[model samples]
Target: MSDNFPPPPPEQPQPEPERPVPVQPSPWAAPAAPPGKQRTGLIVTLAVGGGLVVAGAVVALVYAAMSSVQDSIALPPRSETPYSEPYEEEPYEEEPYAEGPSATEADAKKDVTITACTRDPQIGWQSAKVKVVNGSSTTASYTIMMEFLDEDGVKVAEGGAGVVDLEPGASAVKKAQGLGEVPPGTTCRIGDVWRTPSDRSGS
Candidate 1:
């Protein structure tokens, strides 16, 4: 018998003691977070920085728009002069009458004189007669204005008469008629006398 028992199973090698694997952290795995307080502080810092960048961009855009609007608008020019009050006009004053004798009074004194005046009543008219004397040296024509006065000395009617070509120092009768009735107690007087150069031959 050749020791045919399967050669006694080769002496099995004694099992080596199992060694523990060194646990190396994986490269892609997320790192373990720190304490709760430190982690909250890191998140707050990142948020504040992001907000600042966004605010800066908004401010830049607003400033550019405002600049463009200001350049496009036109403003009116300012005046250098100060304000002044309106001009006012002065009030007007009237001139007073001059003190002197009128032209008619001077002509009457130098040319003729009235000697007598009379008024007589006719059918439908009251006739006035005036006696005039030419005081000037030359032959003259005369006009006599007569006024009729009532008893109270108030004038009621007036008329005029003309004498043509009376010689110097000559007397002439001139007559006129008033159309209305002559009231009672009425008297007549010469009101005015005017004289001019005569065209007729004088005696």
Candidate 2:
């Protein structure tokens, strides 16, 4: 029996599941920055900083060198000479001056005679004993000068004495002293003698 059952409804084809739509990138999202550009900028900044450090070091070295050169070229002080040994000064010595009888004593030497010279044992003074005879016709007085002399003949002291009026041809002895501090071995002698005739008109 050929019963015609409706051919099973035309074989239905199963619809394939829809493929997943590729997600399109959203237009509102921020774009990623390039790493290369960032790295290049950092490198440039570092280079500039290193260059400044090197330049500063070079400038400092130049300044130090200039200072050293100036110090080496500077001149020393004008009075910088140093003595090797301490300076010593020499001692001064004085020479004794030579002395002799003065003009008046020289003139009187012819008229006077020195009898003796002596030094006082107690007082350390020098004295002279002189004796003179009046040769004039009238009464005369005598003025005598005595001098103390050192061994070198330097006149150390001087004194004077007077013999009052005496008759002519009379002899008188007078002692005269030289007052001063004298060196040892000092001697005294008559230096000058002046004879003056007495003036009787006023007397």
Candidate 3:
């Protein structure tokens, strides 16, 4: 029977139970990182840091450019000056000596007598009226030269008046003015007188 049927297996021995090993902690040992999650977190952190750096650089550059532009277009400093009050101007006044009669009116020749002499306030001139008498029997024309003398008796100005076509024993009135301003307290006199043939008819 042992030969024909495989003899029953001999009884097997039971295996012993495994015991937990005691592990020693190393001084340099650290927490082990999760492979997938740690890598992803490190990449995100680097990206954020890089963006902040770039943004800071860009802001610095922009600030530098603006400062440069402002400097280039800056205005010059203004100079300070002392202020003073304005001065008033005086009005003009005319001298009293600006009025008088011309020399021609005061000293006419014997043929001419000055009847009136005056200073015109409006025109600022010396004027005179004179009467010329034709003493010659024949018709004649007469000219009288006048001189204006300053207070010192120096001749300062001169002028003349004339009458034309005077008949014998007839008279005519003439007017004259000085060429220049007459000095104050100046005297006027007839410097000379002359006669010429008159073509005019009887008086």
Which of the numbered candidates is closest to the native, going by highest lDDT?
A: 2
What is the number of backbone collisions in each predicted candidate, taken in the order shown? 0, 0, 4
Look at candidate 1 and tell me the lDDT of residue 109. Answer: 41
Global lDDT of each model?
A: 0.70, 0.75, 0.74
Give one digit per residue, the lDDT tens place, for model 1 in 79-181: 8899999889888786643432222455554454444444454443445666667776877777667777778998888778887777888877667655566
lDDT tens digits, residue span 78-176, model 2? 986776887798888866433321234344344456677777777777877777677668776778888888999999998777777778778777778
Sliding window of 10 residues with minimal summed lDDT for model 1:
96-105
How do these models rank on TM-score, best leading?
A: 2, 3, 1
Candidate 1 matches the true fold with a TM-score of 0.41
Task: Give me the displacement of residue 2 in model 1, in angstroms.
Answer: 63
Alpha-carbon RMSD of each model: 20.5, 19.8, 20.3
Clash list (residue pairs), candidate 1: none
1 versus 3: better TM-score goes to:
3
Give candidate 2 misplaced runs (Cα > 4 Å).
1-111, 201-203
Between which residue pairs do clashes occur in model 2? none
Model 3 pairs in collision: 103-188, 104-146, 107-189, 107-190
Error of 1 at 84 (Å): 22
